[model samples]
Target: MNTTDIIGTIGVSLILIAYFLNIFSLIKKDGNLFYILNIFGGAIACFSSYLIRFWPFVILEGTWAVISVVALLKSIKKPQD
Candidate 1:
């Protein structure tokens, strides 16, 4: 309805889309696109939470974003075949 809600909905939509695709075998869990979706989604969600001064979700989504980044990095460093 408002800016916060709109932003949060978009962020959540991205995350859900990624999950749904993964569940349907449309996207690989370990693939870059999966991680990218999580990274951006978590970041946008975290930002919305910050704008609303919601510390709990700010912490949660911030952690999610950070963890996704770490995962992406690890995947990138894997020895190529």
Candidate 2:
């Protein structure tokens, strides 16, 4: 495998590990920011794997990241009792 592929693989792996850890309670899910950032970073790294050749992942990650960030921001701003 090429260096780019290796690097991308590592990045994706790390993100997935982090994601699952959070979900399983091994890591703290303290706030929306963490979720948003991890997903956003994962999506970016996954999309980059396509290396400007195919663009499916680009759209998938882009939409997911945007939605995640928006939802996170909304949650943070909502009034609390």
lDDT per residue (tens digit) for residues 1-81 in model 2 = 877677567656656766787888876664564665556565666567567555676666556567667767777897866
Tens digits of per-residue lDDT for model 1 on 1-81? 999999998888888988999999999999989999999999999999999999999999999889999999999999878
Specify the highest-lDDT model's number.
Answer: 1
Q: Can you list the residue pairs that collide in candidate 1?
A: none
lDDT of all predictions: 0.93, 0.65
RMSD (Cα, Å) for all candidates, in order, is: 0.7, 3.1
- Candidate 2, TM-score vs. the true structure? 0.60
Return model 2's CA RMSD, one decimal. 3.1
Clash count for candidate 2 is 0
Clashes of each: 0, 0
Candidate 1 regions exceeding 4 Å error are none
